[model samples]
Target: MSDVKRIATRESYGKALVELGKLHENLVVLDADLAGATKTAMFQKEFPERHIDCGIAEGNMIGVAAGLATTGKVPFASSFAMFAAGRAFEQVRNSVGYPKLNVKIGATHAGISVGEDGATHQCNEDIALMRTIPGMVVINPSDDVEAKAAVKAAYEHEGPVYLRFGRLAVPVINDNPEYKFELGKGIVLREGTDVTIIATGLEVSESLEAAKKLEADGISAKVINIHTIKPLDEKLVIESAKETGKVVTVEEHSVIGGLGSAVCDVLSENYPVKVLKIGVNDVFGESGPALELIKKYELDADSIYKKVKAFVS
Candidate 1:
């Protein structure tokens, strides 16, 4: 795992923006003075005129993006997840979501992976918040390849889209040629029958690794990568839950109102499977090394393997 090539989704977001900018003349980017950290600087470097820095005002930035969308400009509002989703909640809900504007939010530095920035900047609640907005498409891409695909998909889609990207460099899992990126689809990475492990964002690769450990212990675990959360792949989730009879959802966000809750919402009304959610257990993240925080929060592969094993037995 250590030797595997790793790239942060934030970096992928920037590079994707550059490629999109080249194709779409109406594509415009707005950032709240964190271009370098959020990796929107790559887009700024490529298209100086198309990039607009809102100078630290996240709420205003959202309003500006909404305005740009009104005039047929495809605007991508970029910022840290804390500000993009948390600070600009009112503006996003009213300005972009209410009218169902064609706005793409590139929210980077999401989850506890933000590291030394602490709870103030590490936004575990963004997914929950964004999910509440009507007609808002929520996407949390797993790796570099998926992140780039998601950015392009968001641009093509005709409504409000929230894209969550991580600061921590994670392994590239979906580098295969067969990997396809659809707006509201879930990809089954590994299939099993004991328990279904549904994960999003940075936790996807970890869930895949955990599945291998469960296999070695005679416990089969199906791993599913759910990139799109709002319009969740209910069919795939229900089918997998019915087959496995047990479900475990892993995420870098909180157990409450995140991927775990989303899966529970679908299964409870449809399949009614027992589920164990692996995530930040309703607590704020502390300042620490990114990798150390993941281990401390028990979201690493080894920790997930143990938790899923206990749940199965």
Candidate 2:
């Protein structure tokens, strides 16, 4: 992981969109006037003809994406998570999700990692909103590699998809040359019998670091990366829960309706194991440095280690 380069998942999504644009002529990219910040500017620069800046109108952009989908074009709608998932909720729900249109919503700047932008710009409920839409695929990638692969997967999949990306640069933990990104599959990064740590997004890398610290304390911890949120890999979650007997879920989103709640739902019905969810306690994030905010919210490596230690006891 240390040898690998650090890059934001949003950056990876931008580069992937550009590469995918080269492969598919019908691939259209749309942004709500934040391409440079969301990194969709990368695609606009390469294919200005196909890239549409729908100004600041996120709702209108979603409708346009759905209309384009009806015409057999794969439209990737881009915007900040708050506006894309919040302001455009009605449009996305009816136009794209309800009709099962072949539109992909690339929601950037999701979660608290949006940093100094404060609570209004930070979107902590995007996952919950997308999960409610029937047949919508929700993917939150763990690293640059996964982000790129998830974007391609969303393009190939025939239906509405919500792809979440972060603003903060995260360490690459899935540098295993053999690592492959599947749509609904969860990968167990570390094998341990004591406790299992289920995490997604930036917390995936932080959880890995926490696992190392737990290992030193003679508390072996298994780390699982769940890049796909909606169509969760129930088999991996249940099997890991059964093996470890205890589970700890970590994420940068709210504990209410994000990865932690999703994991608990799976375990409670199938394996019935205890799960400790470490996330924002249904509270808004404040303006601060991204890394410092992560630590303040207790979403960092040390916080995970401490929480899991208390849980396993």
Instruction: Report lDDT per candidate.
Output: 0.95, 0.93
lDDT of 1 by residue, 1-313 (tens): 9888999999999999999999999999999999999898999999999999999899999999999999999999999999999999999999999999999999999999999999899999999999999999999999999999999999999999999999999999999999999988999999899999999999999999999888889998999999999899999999999999999999999899998999999999998979999999999999999999999999999999999999999
The lowest-lDDT stretch of 10 consecutive residues in candidate 1 is 207-216
Candidate 2 lDDT, 1-313, residue by residue in tens: 5576899999999999999999999999999999998899999999999999999999999999999999999999999999999999999999988889999999999998999999998899999899889999999999998999999999999999999999989987776788998999999899999999999999999999999999999999999999999899999999998898999999888899889888988888888988899988889999999989999999989999999998998
Stretches of candidate 2 above 4 Å error?
A: 1-4
TM-score of 1: 0.99
Could you tell me how far off, in angstroms, the CA of residue 28 lies in candidate 1 after the best superposition?
0.2
TM-score of each candidate structure, all chains considered together: 0.99, 0.98
What total of clashing residue pairs does each candidate reach?
Answer: 0, 0
